[model samples]
Target: MAEEKKEFWRWTESNWKSPDINWNDAKYMTVGIDVGSVSSQAVIMADGKVMAYGNMRTGSDSPNSARNALKFALEAIGDMPEDRMDYCIGTGYGRVNVPFADRSITEIACHARGANFIYGPQVRTVLDVGGQDIKAIQCDEKGKVTNFLMNDKCAAGTGRGMEVFSDLLGVPIQEVGDRSFEFKGEEPAAVSSTCVVYAKSEATGLLRKGWTKEEVLAAYCKAMAERIYSLVERVGVKAEFAVTGGMAKNRGVMDRVMPFVGLERMKTEWDTQIAGAAGAALFGFALCKKGKGRKK
Candidate 1:
């Protein structure tokens, strides 16, 4: 589980229509799904707002996980008309296997789309912390991404990273964020080792040596945040760096992150975590519009 530098890749379709599309048809409702390694999200767009959003853990197989996520969101949407549900867009690691989608998009694009939509025009860099992947994206004025980097292979700075530590600390994952914000000084322990296996083992030694649980956890958080900061800095650290993805909810990560940056906003808007799904929903709506144009 060592920290590995990875790519923040972005792919946009200039003429992205899948040959399977029948653009002559028109539909009123749209849906999007973002399938990540550890979790999947689904969203529905109707009535000028997101009608439903559902999130679920991805099982051993990712395709099933994508279906399960979409099923959950469809259930949440209740009663949208079947004929009007024109498009289903999919993004994320498992986007290609999302059989129901009209088009598959890169997670980077979806994240940018989702962040720009939620945070408006100000966001230039997006920091996304997924369950199994973490990415830092740089985008221009129109929410179109310019460059990106991703750590799809590691658990060092992701939701899974926190989960592992929570288990070690006997802290619930939901509350880990709240508790980490209470620490008072530089952590006595340094979870600085690159490999998670080594770091976790080192963490135990720190605890056995009489280091308070708070300091050890704080140290771990700091180390993890520093890793994320490196990725953000790679994206150039523009004024409005917004954060999204599952790990965005962790206060521990945020606390350690805020004091180190000179950007206008240290943390990202809360909804950015759901940016991938939201972008999918918007992309679905775009498909519906495309269908109308072909008929005219």
Candidate 2:
């Protein structure tokens, strides 16, 4: 048999529930489903705080992805029935495809709101780098978006772009961050192209010329940082900034971009990938408070 190639770009999936929270005691239960191009997240909130959440890879069928994410989350609360949710909101690239959602909100708004919740009310700026796009958003104390800019036209500077390099370099996606700092001497200059196709070719040539894999990884990270910084510049950065999405977990890119932006990222105990879904859940909570919950 031919040797099986290891998949280096896959990230770990997870689900969790707050140990102290008992869903049966909650007066209101809400759910938010965020189905993106690369991943799907489901967040269940009891009253206004998170009770359980699930993070998983997005499937080809968006509705199925949404259902699976919810099921995964519900697994954390074994006896909770799906019908107990008072309201449901959907967000992200596949927001419209969430069949059970009472309403759909834009990821931009959801992210801003979620950032406020995760990073605290002090967060006024949020940079979300997802699978296929980047978003820079500025919001007020209440998490209302004031201004935002998104680069969805290309895959450069996003998770997908990093995945391509991970495969090309034969590095595990999780190890790319730590390994990038292993090269000797000063950091190398960034790769020339922001376009993934052209950049891949450039990396191949650099390897042929004897550039080490770590050096190439560092260069690509620098390139990714520069590209991301450029987009954040257009919308402007504010103090108490926070980063969300998959890229927030990648130190190779985050470390490179932070110095350029000149702001320390706000700390959050919650998973960054769940921001959009958490925000959606929060929105559902607000609607429920307004007596707008789904009618039986």
Clash number for each model: 6, 0
Q: Put down candidate 1 lDDT per residue, 1-296, tens digits, no spaces.
A: 98673322111101011223332332456677888876788776662256666777767876787778766765554444444566777899888988777788899988988888777778888888887777889887677898899888777777776777777877767677777765676555447674567778988988898876677777878888887787777777776877788777777886667566565453443344468988877876766666631122
Model 1 C-alpha RMSD to native: 8.8
**How does candidate 1 score on lDDT?**
0.71
Provide TM-scores for the models: 0.83, 0.98
> Taking the tens digit of each residue's C-alpha lDDT, what string does model 2 give over 142-193?
9999999988889899998888899999999999998888899999999999
lDDT of each: 0.71, 0.94
Off by over 4 Å in 1: 1-27, 81-83, 264-270, 292-296
TM-score, cand. 2: 0.98
Residue 161 lDDT (model 1): 69
Q: Cα deviation in Å at residue 207, candidate 1?
A: 1.5
lDDT of 2 at 209: 94
